[model samples]
Target: MATTLFFLLFFTPFLYSAAAPNHNAPQDLVRSSCINASYPSLCLRTLSSYSGPTGTPRDLAQAAVKVGLARARKASTYLKTSVTGKSERERAALSDCVEQMAESVDELSKTLSELKHLRGETFEFQMSNARTWVSAALTYEDTCVDGFEGVDRKVKGDVKKKITNVAMVTSNALYMIRRLDESGGLNR
Candidate 1:
C-alpha cells in the first residue's frame, strides 16, 4: 500500500499534465518577456492614442466604416502571404475582416440615405452615385472569395476601403452633404 501510494502521488501529476488540452496551455513566459522587451512602449502608445469617442454620441456608422477599412487592409495582406494548409487561422481572420467590411458598407449606405433625405436636392445625385459605388464594391467583395481547397469559396480584401472611400467622397461631393450631416468630415 505504501509503494502504491508513492507511485500514485508521483505519476498523478504527469498523467494530468498529459491529459490537459493543448489550447489551455500557458503561454511561454520567456517569449512574452522578449516581446515586451522589444516592443517597449508601443502598446502603451497605441492605447493612449485610441481615438474612439468616450463621451459623445458614438457614431456607429463612422466607426463601422473605419473598422471595415482596417479589416479589409489586414485581410489583403494576409491573402497575399498566406500559404495553403497553413492558413487556417489566417483564413479565419480574413473571413472575419471581410464580414466586418461588408457590415460597415451596409451601415454607411443607410447613413448616406438618411443624409440624402435630410439634404434633399443638394445630395441627390451624389448620394445616388455613392450608393452605386458601394453596391458595386460589396458585390465585388462578395464574389472575390471563390474556390477554396477544391470547394467554391468567396474571399475579398480591402473592399471596405473602396466602398468607404467612395461613400466618403460622395459624402463630400456637395458642401451640403458634409454640412447637413453631423457625422464629421470624410477625412475623419
Candidate 2:
C-alpha cells in the first residue's frame, strides 16, 4: 500500500512535468508565449511595424497600400505575358487578379478623393466603402494565392508575377480599410 502511494506521488509529478513541457514545445512555443503575453494589441502593433509606423491602424493601412502597389506593378507585367497562352484556369486567375487590381485602384482613388471632403457624418460612408474595398481585395488575394498552390516551382516568370500583383492589390485594399477603421470613421 505504501509503495502504491509512493508511486502515485512520484509518477504523477513526473507525468505533469512531462506534459508541461509539451505546452512549451518547440513547434510554436515562441509564438504562443508572445501571443499569451500581449494578444490582440501586440498583434496589431506587430502588423503595423511592417509599415514602419507605430501601432496606429492608419499606418498599418498605409503600409499595406504601399506593398500592394509594388506587388501589383510586378504582377501586372507577368499577367500580361502569361495570359497570352495559358490553360483556362491560369487565364481565369490572371484575369481575376487584373480585375481586382483595377477595382482596388479605383476604390483607393475614390476614398482619397472623399477624404478631402470628409465631414463627421460622411465618415460612415467612407468607412463602408473602405470595408467593401478591403473585402474585395482580400477575396482577390485568396484567389491568386490558391491558384499558385501546387503550381510547379518552375512556373514561368509571368505566372509568378501575376500572382504577386494580385497579392499586392489585395494588400493595399486591406490597408485602406485599416486606415478608415483607425480614423474612427467606422466606429459608428
Candidate 3:
C-alpha cells in the first residue's frame, strides 16, 4: 500500500503536466483584453478567427496585426483602382485619399513587423513601436475619410464606409497589442 501511494504521488504530477493547457484560457484572455478597447465588438470580430480556445495571446496579437495589415492593403488597392467623383475636384481628392490609404497600409505593415519581432528583453520598445505604427495607420485612415469632406454625399459615404472598416480593425489591433504589452503575455 505504501509503495502504491508513493507511485501515485510521484506519477500524478507528471501525468497532469503531460496534459494540454486549458483550451478555454486563450478565449477568456481575448474577451478580457478586448473589454477595454474602443470598439469591443469590432475587436472581437477582427480576432474571432485567430482567438481560438487554444490560442496564445502573443499569437493572437500577431494574427491581429497581420490580418489588419492585409485589410489595409486591400483597402488601398481598391481605392487606387476605383474611379471616384464626377468632377476634377472630386477626382483630385479621391486620388489624394488613395495615397493616404497606401500610407496607412505601410504603417500597418510596420506594425505587423514590430509585433513579430517582439523579444522579452525589448518587449516595451517593440510594443511602443507597434503602438506608434497603429496610431499612424488609424490617422491615415481617418484622413482618407476627411478628404471626401466636400464631395457629394454618395461618394463621401461610400469612401468613408470602406476606410472606416480598415480604421476599426487597426484600432482593434492596437488594443490587442496593448493587452499583450501590459499583460506581459508576450513571454507566455
**Which candidate's TM-score is highest?**
3
Model 2, C-alpha of 42: deviation from truth (Å): 14
Instruction: Provide the lowest-lDDT 10-residue window in model 3.
Output: 45-54
- At residue 36, candidate 1 shows an lDDT of 33
- The predicted structure with the larger lDDT, 1 or 2, is 2
TM-score of each: 0.33, 0.47, 0.81
For model 1, how does the per-residue alpha-carbon lDDT over 1-188 read when each residue is reduced to its tens digit? 99999999999999998988764211232122123322224322322233653111122223333433454454445544543553565466445544544654454455545533434455455545544544454444444343232332232233333434433332322222222234442322
In terms of lDDT, the best-performing candidate is 3
Q: Rank the candidates by TM-score, best first.
A: 3, 2, 1
RMSD of 1: 19.8
Q: Give the count of colliding residue pairs in each prediction.
A: 6, 3, 0
Rate residue 123 of model 3 by lDDT: 85
* True-vs-predicted CA distance for residue 29, candidate 1, Å: 42
Report lDDT (CA) for all predictions: 0.40, 0.52, 0.78
Better of 1 and 3 by lDDT: 3
Q: Write candidate 2's Cα lDDT for 86-107 as tens digits.
A: 6676677667666755665555
The lDDT of model 2 is 0.52
Cα deviation in Å at residue 130, candidate 2?
A: 0.5
Candidate 1, residue 37: the lDDT equals 26
RMSD of each: 19.8, 12.3, 5.0
